[model samples]
Target: MSEQAAPLRRERRTFALGLLAGVFGLLLVPTCTSCGGADESQAETRPLVLSTIGQIHDIASTLAGDDLRTEVLLGAGLDPHTHRPTRADAARLTAADLVLENGLHLEALLHATLDARRASARPVVAVGESIPAEQRLAVGGAGALADDPHLWMDPVLWAEVARAVARELSDLAPAAAPDIARRLEGVLAELAELDAYARRSIDSIPAERRLLVTAHDAFGYFGRRYGIEVASVQGISTESEASVRHVQELVNLLVEREVPAIFVESSVSVRGPRALVEGAAARGHQVVVAGELYSDSMGPPGTYRGTYVGMLDHNITLITRALGGDAPAAGLRDRL
Candidate 1:
């Protein structure tokens, strides 16, 4: 086999094996209806659902309803691409009834730790991998990752992830299947509405100024889904270095298109886009860092921007206003 195909084959094989193992592991969990009312009461206790990122945790928490205790290993603004597993994180990983992750190499540093847990019959799943290969976008850069893990940027695509989370949580807590499925339905409907709002709002931008430039190439999926042209300094993985050539290319595009605004990410350094602005200035073209976007992470907790809906709302609101499109200042539902 060729070098490129080898990894693809291995990934497929691993996923297939993991799927079987996960199902078998679920079967091993004893189901006792003998206690009747007692068992039903205890079922309310819920499982401890651990996720890798806050976004996934939030979605799972919403889907898990009030029953499951969902928590994330990484907090707001942490870059998952380079985050390493600490001793405390490892302890939490083992303690979780079921661990949820983005996968597609998003948690590159924690693969070994997650793998170890899965081998021991602990349920560790990369829910993002549940999105089919055909749906994922490819990115390019020196030493960059092959697939984009930022599926959450697009609500339509994220609905796929929501479905995946519902399946895994249902498997772990069969007694709560009805509740979980009900919540999943509600979440999906909200996401569908959000997707429609995004499409309408983004389409308002003038065709010429609909270009979206950011610090990194995390918006490929977003751009594809929303009908916007995207450019970036770095690759899919934030770990990839930004070359001057790439920056210059983006600067040229900015200048050529006279793109009025670009954006920075909360989790990625502003240095990349900052350089692009300076480079554009040198050539008599001006670009502003219109706003900060939630790329790899979401906003602070207890805030509107912290939730999955809020994250996308912020992106849509910021992009529309900055790109000369019209959107309610507060966003789709005046909830910003």
Candidate 2:
């Protein structure tokens, strides 16, 4: 084989080896099948097993309707930039018929990790890969995530990602394509409404107060979509810490601009941001922690912001309201 062809063949070879192992051994014996529930609860109409990020898992679960059997490797509050898969995640990779990688380097470390598993005939579908070029944005500065991976920030792009995921899962289990597509369409419609509502809500906020300083640069995509000035104390990865100079600079900005409130993230460490708030206070400028926003992970199940749509809607409300704009609770579904 040629140079490029060599690795391709090896990838196929590894996958074939895994396929044989699944065929011969009892590894696929479904030990964690029920997830502590009955058989029906355990397996959906098509038990679309997934090993990827949680955002995709949440969207897939909602779209698939049934159990869907999603095992998130990089879980809530776990940063994928620094995630090193353990043996447990390896088992999930092997069992998954469809490995739904986020595609964008969001799960930068995970692509190679799951590729190593090479699930039998299972496809490691990069759902974000199918995202259209127009909707995509560039990651800030020189780095691996130079092409922004956090596309879930934009609901339109997120809808595309969700559709691709649903389609890939459908192909893996064609019997459920119709069901998956139907649920996905409903979700996209809801997302469109959410986007419109967000536009109207944030539009009311003064441009001067549109500055959003987050815990990290994860909101690049969100900021771009909403015309907000976005800055983060840390870089793209939470593993990357803020430099002394960077922290000092942000404090000075807070003091000079009198930026009232800064937002914290659910998944990232708050220690860095706490220092910023305290630093601002020492300078006689009080910066409020407006609210905790869902960044890499969504809220717990059954809440308003658990899914991708609800997550952003909740964020829009918190940011707009905190920043002197208005987004009523009833705007989404119920009274605010």
Candidate 3:
């Protein structure tokens, strides 16, 4: 047989065997279909792993490595809090082998679609929900922010979510468990490094200027983890409207603290922070609009900022610099 046709023949044999094994309720042992030895190329035919957003996609991709094909349901610059799924989204969920999400009310409108799929026995996991309850933050007073869904803001907390995703993927594809575990260990190490960088950089900020004013309350976890005081006009969810009183209060705090800059979240509109700037200026306090921060979503796909590590690095670098902290101009690894 020609070398070019060898892989095709192996794939056919494997498919036939997999069907027979399924009929007998036996697990089919996976093999490297390309060259008769262990190789990751055959993973191109692996199960489909669907994620709700880019952050989760990065986690799933990191864990799955070359063992599975992972994709994100939501694209860049999309707000998960206010996102409403379309018919195509419903179809994607229906066709998913496993659906992963942040899941602390992050995809509020998309939950029903995911639930419908789950009710039918589809493998859908909310990786972020796996975090310990005590570690989770509560939003506003009672109405909103009851459970903060922005866990990715904290590298340590997100490491736990990555582990949960690894377990879920491994359970679904037992043959690839060993590979998944190995990659997960590496991912955890990177996350730990990112966490350490965040701590050291944020700690260097001048104590009095450690105020993080943003468009929304997506940074509560970040604030709690990094020792910055977070203030936002909108509550946890961007769907909530900001009241005049809230804006006024932020303006007052800005003037009182003489905060130099206010940031706008990438996934949210710039109007909130602009209002704060105007309000602060009206009170004779000039608060410049700082750089944008990745909150509910990651950066554009295919960019460094789009990856999980890049997203956090960008945030830490921006926060440190804007708040008068010491950090490299290019961020953690000169990749900013």
Query: Tens digit of lDDT per residue, candidate 2, span 1-336?
Result: 579999999999999999999876665455545444576664455464674777788777777676355656666667777778777877777767667877667777776666675534556877877877666776656564356678888887788787887777787667777888888888888879978887888788887878888898888877877888888888887778898889888888878877788999988888878888999999999999998988877777556676666788788888888888877855466522
After TM-score superposition, the amount by which residue 64's alpha carbon in candidate 1 deviates from its true location, in angstroms, is 1.1
Best candidate (score: TM-score): 3
Per-residue CA lDDT of model 3 for 256-336, tens digit only, reads: 988899899888989889999999999999999879999888898899999999998998999899888999989998998
Give lDDT per model, in order: 0.89, 0.77, 0.88
The CA lDDT at 276 in model 3 is 92
Q: What is the TM-score ranking, best to worst?
A: 3, 1, 2
Top candidate, metric lDDT: 1
Question: Could you tell which candidate, 1 or 3, scores higher by lDDT?
Answer: 1
Better of 2 and 3 by TM-score: 3
Please give the RMSD of candidate 1 to the true structure: 20.8
Give one digit per residue, the lDDT tens place, for model 1 in 1-336.
789999999999999999999998777664444457677777666689999998899899998887778999999989999998999999999989999999988999999999999899998888888888989986654685377888898888899899999999998888889999999999999899889888988999989988999888889888999999988878788988888887889888889888899999999999888899899999999899999999899999989899888888999999999989988899976878
Clashes per prediction?
Answer: 0, 4, 1
TM-score result, candidate 2: 0.80
Q: Which is superior by lDDT, 2 or 3?
A: 3
